[model samples]
Target: MTSHQLTAGICSRLNEPEHSDELLSSTPIVQILSVKRVGSTNGPNPIDRYRIIVSDGEHFLQSMLATQLNHFVDDGKINKNTICRLDKFTCNMVQEKRLLIVLAVTVLEQSTTKIGSPVGLQNPPGDAVASPATAQQTPAANALSTTSTAPAVSSSTTTTPAAVRGQGARSGRGPNIFPIEGLSPYQNNWTIRARVTNKSEIKTWSNQRGEGKLFNVTFMDESGEIRGTAFNMVADALYDKLEEGKVYFISKAKVNLAKKQFNNVANEYELGLEKNTEVEECRDSSNFPVVRYNFIDLAKLQDMAKDALCDVIAIVKEIGDATEFTSKFGKTSLKRELTVVDRSGFSVRLTLWAKNAEKFTHTDQPVVALKGVKVGDFGGRNLTMTSSSSLEVNPDIPESHALRGWFDAGGNSENFQSHTNAFSGGGAVAFNRAEMMSLEEVKVKELGGSDKTDYFSTKATVMHLKPENIAYPACPTQGCSKKVFDQHDGWRCEKCDRSFEKPEYRYASTTVTAGCASADPVSSRYMISMAVSDYSGQAWFQGFNDLGEVLFKRPANELVAIRDRDEAKFTKLVEDVTGQQFNFSCRAKQDTYNETTRTRYGVQKILPLDYAEEARHLMELLAAPWAQ
Candidate 1:
């Protein structure tokens, strides 16, 4: 029979002054006496620094297990009485007491029974009493309250381990909670006490990596906020327990770099919970922080990066009727547009989707506070609600109250800069809102000289209309608007490579209007080949089939039939539109036709005259310093 000898090398020599510094730089074999998890304070995501007591049968010393080594305890490989060989360590003097930091360690022997008791009683420097060898191994039951005068190796810069533990013991309220900003992938042993700010529905996915059920949670503390995900068994365990707005004491979650594309939280790191993760509700979480928003002013939204999450506080000046549409997946999606204004004297469009759109109620133009809304651009800057986003209607926050006060004090009546009409959707035409240029000034500016078209609004009376070629056959494809050739059988579109049994008819009208009575002979007539007019001047405007039909309040096919069947009726219709005042949005571009270089003005959009908006524009013009 071979006798087994359990020997502690440097662990026994730890008390010796000479061996201490030398062994601290090198690896040493020791017997583990006990290990305890100490909670962190200061940040929401706090890494737990393990207080480990080791013995060599002759002497005992205290050390801290690096957070990276948390897996050892989690795997049940570093229990009391287990023998381990430290591969790397650092010794730092904290609060005048020397503490050993275990950077790396390997199990030498696994044991469930107790090891030898404390050999000789020697207090660690600055300690009043020596740690008892027979102390209970369970951290919760027999954990000693130890304060760190200094930080552990590679610990967070803002806080120290001993201080956290000491505070917990002295205050009896537990350790200082950590904020989300303090979290990083470099540490693992941490506990986060955070309020669940946002929660996502369970989602399942399968690929080459396999399939599993997962859910996400957004949490925040005083310092910052972060997003976390739990998959498979961990998700099943914690899903029902996670309630939005509830604070929880969570530990043992793995931290990783956040995937910027998917995560909207400002934190650089996110959390992943595993089977060993601990989650306990913090009932007395009055101290826990609520989610904070760093709102971007409404005027600054246009300059921000596209798709960025935006926090904004604004007054709901206008709300569009909710519209329902079927997505490509056949899912019904509801959308509504809201015009929100802020103190910056600017207004932007916010698109609400799904429940936010359907459940929205307009009451007294309540203040709309948004967090984590996705920025969008159609014609100009717009916003969309994301799953992780939240909307507060007339929230009692300071910003909301301030906006309410501002709006009530005649703020909405002020001339607000508008970013929505800056450009038209998917068109080359840009929006011209403030300045009403004369026909000569439009040509001088060469509005549509560039690749993109320039847009301007004008008030003018229609002088004449070229009723010929007023309506044309178009391809019936939903998005394709190419002209189709009328065939005996049907209509064919070269671009679409398909023939339609029945072609959709569209109106493209070329109407001429005079800018001013005293304008130049040739350029005075503002030729709006299509689109609206106000009182400014006539410009060449062209309106497409849909817009033309909208203006005529009749379908293109019906109009075309009337034109073909009754010349007198068509003439009356054309004559009725002529000499009428209208507000028109016109697109200008230069084109060469049969050796003739001409600037063509096309009508892209038409808006019914808003007496208030026109009055505002006129007021702005009158208030201009140049005008004075």
Candidate 2:
């Protein structure tokens, strides 16, 4: 490459912000001197940062290769003596050193010879050094420096303007302060002053690889937010050092691609704390934002897709007792449900799990604010707090205060529509707290014809029952409900890969009963198919174990024993359930088999007739038109 091809003194000139437009239009070419990788390769998503020394033929400056341009180095197209034009880049000052972040480049020429003798740029002699207070505050300045002591020059020495106006600055802490939104795997030797909006408890996990503990914290600044995670020993050391709602000057953390499945932060990159990571609590946190939320109204949850994460603020209208349940993996966990209402005159069920469920004791209808809560569409629309979620009670934010005042005035006594039930007009009632629909209306509306399943409630009387194939033997394991087959010597559950002396009885579904032809039964559980009738029409519905327990008033095992002992008594017991009316919440979906298609209605919940509540609901409906 010719000496004239390289722009001499361009390395120093690029640091000045005023000449950005001129330089960008000119597209100055430079020669690559060396490239080195920084940071460890061990992490969920390994960091691949490249530090390159580029020369303008007169002065060589340390620059960073943007992750988007890694292919240039990996492909060996940009090596020593390779000439490239700086198409787009940003100049950031770190520890009184100019660091150029190359965003876009165009390879110009490749050669095996040096263009010119270039020397590293140095600060002017006799410049005042940074004071001890400033040096102590900027930890990254020392941590990332190659020398034992970095010579920090005074602000007036060169005055490197930030490439992005108002995006980068030198804080009082002395290091280049970067916005959380701007931090990526490409940049290094930078610090961020952000508030720790939320922190999680240390959680341990055991897998085939090994067992280790980890915790996460969400950090936010005015620009944006990012999630930080520390693992094992690092987690233990920093969990207490970082407190929620406190601002800190964090540095030396590895930045990696954000795992969207585990992270809900808006930033594209996340932080991983290594052993050398530094976290210094900032005493002057008044200027930092506490927490930011993009809250969605409770009424809008009905339209959100299942398992979508959202933020919400509401008042705790009712709280349910904590309940314990064993997961399919046999791990026991606790969960509590809360009925929360907001100013939109809508209520939703929010479920808290594990520690959050155990620690909740608020009972004064305090306003609650939640971030990253997952939406559920089981019985109806609901919300669930996962490990990544942040929950606050009676938060000090303006929205929380406004909600508290509204509830104290007249909102507390106001009738709120619930997400659990479908609404109509000003005041309309359903049969079982859900949208009431007749069998004829359900068919006319083609409820189950669509791609999505439809749910509704109706009042109907049992007309007939399917007596055969009512129950099956299930796996005896606490959480394993798969059907078990009799193996003569022992019962076997193919799914669990284990055999037992006997199997536990569980109500069987029609789907499961079809598979029983290949296996012998051991014990029996409730799985009932019944024909139900109303004034509009009759429909066939399937009720599983729980719904059967409510209708039969006896366990499946007991019913099976009675059938074997006295056929007449079993027949009478089955007949007694006929002609009894109940409110049924049903889910209707289209099922296809052997080229045949039909709508299958499955009972979700069975509620006994509440005559008093039903009468009140009717009265409200009758008065709605008059009031209107």
Candidate 3:
């Protein structure tokens, strides 16, 4: 029978000096303990670092007998069984790569007592120590702890060992395939020495679906990346037991197929932590792989065309108003678009939808990171935004600092063209109540031309409304203001129906003023769309039937009558306010019949009113100008 020192060479690789002194001074015999590749040498897969296994008595016990472990088994250097001698070997920490040596010599202390205070046991004091020969066998476990204080190896070396890990095991088991790149050959039941890398504990649920929990974790071997998910029972079983960036030995998984759709995380596939899944915190995590990526440059993306999927980092230069626009998606949501520029000599439009838009409004930097954003051409040649991708703002990254510097130093112009603040020039109506005014306030007023700036405002009342008193419906199609010919089958709105089942009804929402108008002339741009709307209604009315409503229901004559009546009332309202000189602006346009050509028949003309001092009879609110 062979009498041997069970623990051998394992200490020199350790930077700890104490292990050296203890190993050299005492003599208990241990064997050669080295981890090596089992067979072929194609070198470690580029994606992963390495896979190796180490063992001692606890793992060699009873259960492993039936299986022929020789396929993966590689003999270590021969060592003679001994009593008065010591042995030593080394291993590298899987994640941090810190050198750790195991001393397999005898010690005055007993080996059966607790090794390093792993979890449950703490070292005992006093003089109940073992003889020098027995104590030397302890593998320097006394110095090990959960937190490492040793120096880490360079990232350049992410390696794996062969002995106990190979393409196939002798136990008639098929080759195990690791999901990581270059690991397909070992597709059956090959064991991988990996680091937990990242883990999320299971969250128990006792909800409507019954009771259970689901948890996940990310494991990284020297080869590449793979994610694992544990549901219900599995989550409860393992969630609390794992920690991030730790190494482990894994085996006995079903090695089923990978489904990308089931993968919601950035990872490529979803791994199931199944019933046969086996996971053990590696007692010997000698080697492992690490992965890293060279992120794309954001500054270059500024000059890239729209819809181009490129990475980008930029400071929010200016935020525009989030005008409500119906999308083809058939839902009404708020979206704000803005211009962001990098150090390049170009700028692009970024559309922030809903919460992101609102969030941008309140942000100080609005610095955003686009990992894989698609560019788009909008409003002609300008870059537009889309949601097919994702966006992040002010992430905890180094590029953030670089971008901030570029923006602060006027480097944005090099990459982007920024539009001057239009809203600041009074073009925006979002100012305070004092500075802000609605399109309706100046709705009736017509102020236009560069030289013309006789800004005046006053209220009015209803007088004699024109014959345009009837109401009408509008084209339900977005951007298509043409009236629909009633199919009589129902209210068939061809335009909106194309996008939706039903068309939106037009509310000939305009008030035929038998009411007065404001005294000041408003901007011409304001009435342009309105005139188009009105004329379009007339066109709609031509095709409109008794069964179907038109855009404008009021007859032309009726509209003229309301104008005459409303003009008179408006004069009265103005006179009541100014009292000295009262003149009002009136708006009337040829209704749009066809919106396709973007053409209009009649101009948005103004009508003046004839009024007298009798207007003083109308009741009025207190003048707000200087009431304070």
| TM values, all candidates | 0.43, 0.46, 0.29
Q: For candidate 3, lDDT tens digit of each residue in 468-575?
A: 312233344434544345454644445566332232333233312123332322111111111211211221101111101211233322333444568775344323
lDDT per residue for candidate 1 within 1-628, as digits (tens), equals 1122444555545544333334444556677887766543222123444678777666666677755577798678998888887765554333323346665688878766655565644544454343444323323212222221111222221222333334333434344333344445543444656678778767776679988898889876543467889999889989999998787777778877677667666555678888987777765555444545557798887554446566898988899999999976566678899988899988888998877898897867988888888876567777888767878888767777788888898997988887653322433232345445666677778888877656566556667676777765556565565767878877889998998766555323321111111211210111124333334444556655444554567655556667767989978987777776565556677778999877777665555567997797686567443565
Model 3 off-target regions past 4 Å? 1-157, 160-179, 182-186, 193-212, 242-248, 264-269, 280-291, 297-408, 411-628
Clashes of each: 38, 1, 98
Rank candidates by lDDT, best first. Answer: 2, 1, 3
The candidate scoring highest on TM-score is: 2
Q: Provide the global lDDT of candidate 3 against the true structure.
A: 0.36
Candidate 2: tens digits of C-alpha lDDT, residues 277-304: 9887765555444555668899888655
Model 2: colliding residue pairs = 507-526
State in Å the error of residue 200, model 3.
Answer: 6.5
Worst 10 residues of 1 by lDDT: 515-524
- RMSD of each predicted structure: 24.1, 22.6, 30.2
Residue 325: error of model 1 in Å?
A: 3.9
lDDT for 248 (candidate 1): 74
